[model samples]
Every structure is written in structure tokens, then in C-alpha cells.
Target: MADVSANPRADREENPLERQRELMELLSQETRHSIVQALLGHPKLLASSAELNHFVPSKSKKTVEEQLEVLVDAGIFALYEYPPNEDRRGLPWKFYGLTEYGADVLGDFNYLEGVPMARAVHRKTRKPEQIERHEAAPRPPLPESVRATFRLDEETD
Candidate 1:
């Protein structure tokens, strides 16, 4: 009943790009995709929920939270929490980083890092006030993995 010329694959039982199509569909959502991009561009490859939220300040925090949950469920992200011993008298500090698979997938978009401010690495292109706010934001100690990756070790006395 369908026109074969107009819909050649309509009757096909299998699609060669099914997996990639599914992944694309999942990442098609702007916010979801942006979250991944932000992480991939980060110098330490990690950020807190609060810090990440700043990148999309217009969106409701709950939206970011839910998207993060979805990414974690999809195995694209790993949540890192600050140990209680170093707790800062508030809610547990939550940081996020990509899984190995996530990094591999992100490699497919290496060209995206050429945007303004060079993939959001330096905030110099941002409004001066915005930069001020970001600088003033609380920077909880980065996880040890990030420290080692960025080589921020303390000198032994």
C-alpha cells in the first residue's frame, strides 16, 4: 500500500543505523546534548551540579537535575560525591564526570570544541559580571582523580 519509490526502507525489517539512530534520538534533546558538551569541554572533565547549572541558567534547576539522572541511567555520566569527612555543613557535594564510553562517544564530536571561548574553557568571552560570579562561586575541592589528571598535587613538607 506504500509507494516503494518514496519509502524504500518502509518495508525493511532491519535498519543498519538502528543503534546510532537510537543514540542520536536520545541526544537530540538540546538540554541533554548540552550537558554532555559542557562536560566534554571542561578542563577537569568534571563539574558539580551547581556549576553545571550555571551554564544553562535559564533552565529550571530541576530540569538539569532530571537530565543528569537520565544521563547517569544511560551510563554516560558518573556522579562523584564529596566524602563526609570533608563535608561543608550543607547538602552533599555532587560532581559529575563522563564514563569511558561517554568519552569515546564524545570523541565523535571533537569539532564542537571550536566554538566561542574555546568550548567554554575560558570565561573571558563572557560578561565581566558573569565571570565575576563564576569566580566567586564555591569551588569544593576537586576529586582526587581530577587533581591527578590536572597534576594539582600538594608538595610534601
Candidate 2:
């Protein structure tokens, strides 16, 4: 049998998780992350480097193109030249979209599903009983004189 290590396809198949991890690591960078997110949100759409400016507004066109090329080389995206019949420009626009593998990986991209309190963290609500139980410093009782002056000691029966 041929050594799987010698074959990139066989190596990727043998450890599919590794490929996913590699994809994630590459996307950990802000530019790459933005590019992937843009593609994911607009599947099957071919976006040129100029068009991608909205997704990565902070980056220059050159920087965006460089990152797009990196994603293209990684097999996460397929790059294509704009049709020749289109209006000519200084440089031919390159369009990019997710590859089959990229789409498959994106299908499994649910890393934020378990993100705790991402939506509710800002809203005020009753503190959980667990937190009160674990609190190191219990609140001190108000002095009777101070409570009486503020009528905080008044109780309705």
C-alpha cells in the first residue's frame, strides 16, 4: 500500500478534523475571518476584491486581494478572472467564492452555539442562586438608625 503521508488527499481523508482545524487557524486572522464570513453569508456569489471592501472596510484593496489570494491557495476559495467581454479596467477583476470543501466546512461552523450569555449578558435580571451561594463577601445589614431615617425599616404586615 502507498504511504498515506505521501498523498495529501489521503492524509486529509485520514484526519478530516485536521483540515477543519487548519481552516479555522487560517481564519483566526481578522482579514481572513472577514473574507470567509462574507463568502459564507453570500454563498455562490462571486465577489471581486473591490466589492469585498464593504466586508473588510478597514483594509486597502491591495491587502484584501492578498488575503483573498491566500484563501484561494488554501483551497477554501476558488478565484476566477472576470469575463473578458466585461468593460476593461486597469487590472482584470478577480472574483472569489467558496469551494465545495469550504462550503462543507462552513456547514459545520457552529463554534458560537455554546457562547454563554452572548445576548443576555447586558440585560439586568435576578442574579442566579449559584452566584449568591458562591459569593465571598456577603452584604452587611444596614444600621437600624439609618434604616429608620430612610423608612427602610418599615414593614407591612
Candidate 3:
């Protein structure tokens, strides 16, 4: 075994490079890479979850959503949801956009459309409790408080 006195941090402590490695591993997967690539070339740099599904037709809706959730959790994507329809009959539009950090990672690493490096896929195993919670959890509600208000002369939407 190597000497331990030189290192101060514990074995479990995460450093910046490790986090980036985690992200690279996440993005290296085929389905996840497709999702990122689609957004990279998009005009708005954003896409609805359903739209991302088109990029990876081989995967099911649930799989795409799961991958989107992972990206969202990793802070690589910011989710914007549209209001529910009248009577709240169906799911709201959950649009995922590339966050600034996401854009930087893509640009810096040349992961554009992927495939320069050999794929090292990563899939985290889930515990039973985690699986149950993830399946049962409701979509997170939008914030109710307004921090700032600004007027815009032009409305794109």
C-alpha cells in the first residue's frame, strides 16, 4: 500500500477534476451523448423532453426522461416548464436547455457529436428505496416567489 500521510483529504472527498470526469462519463453514454448533441446545434440551445426523444429513437420515453433528470441534477441542464393545461389534464412541457457550464464542457472537450475517444459508459445502480422514490416523485413545482421583475419591449413567444 502507498503512504497515506501525504494526502490530507479523505478518500471519498470529490475534487473538481473528479466531478468533470463524472460528467464526461455521463456524457459518454450513447443515449446521453445524443441528447447533448441535439441541444448543441439547436437554435435556442434548448429542446423539449419529447423533442430529445427523437434524437434517440432506440430508447423509450422513460429512459430519455431519466437521462434528462440526470443532466438536470448534474446542473448541466436547466429545466423550464410550461404551465399545465386547463383542468391540468396532461403533463406540462419540460424543456431542457444547456446551461453555461454545459456549453463550456462541450466546447472545451470537443465532445461535439462525440466519438473522438473510446466510449466508457457509466450507469449508476439504484437502491430499492431510490427506485421507488424516483418512480413515485411528482414533478418539482415552479418557484412561487418573484425575485425581480423586468419589462421587455419585445415578446418572442
Best candidate according to lDDT: 1
TM-score (C-alpha, index-matched) for candidate 2:
0.54
Measured on C-alpha atoms, candidate 1 has an lDDT of 0.55
Lowest lDDT block of 10, candidate 3: 144-153
Instruction: Say which candidate scores most in TM-score.
Output: 1
lDDT of 3 by residue, 121-145 (tens): 1012222443223223334332221
lDDT of 3 at 124: 27
lDDT of 1 by residue, 26-98 (tens): 6767888777766655545566676567766667889998998877766556775555524654433556766
User: Which residue pairs show backbone clashes in model 2?
Assistant: none
Deviating ranges (above 4 Å) for candidate 2: 1-11, 88-93, 111-157
TM-score of each: 0.61, 0.54, 0.55
**Tens-digit lDDT track of model 2 for 5-124:** 122334488788887687678878889887765544321244555446555778887888899878776655666554452455333345565555454455457523322232233123
lDDT score of model 3? 0.51
**Candidate scoring better on TM-score of 1 and 3:** 1
1 versus 2: better TM-score goes to: 1
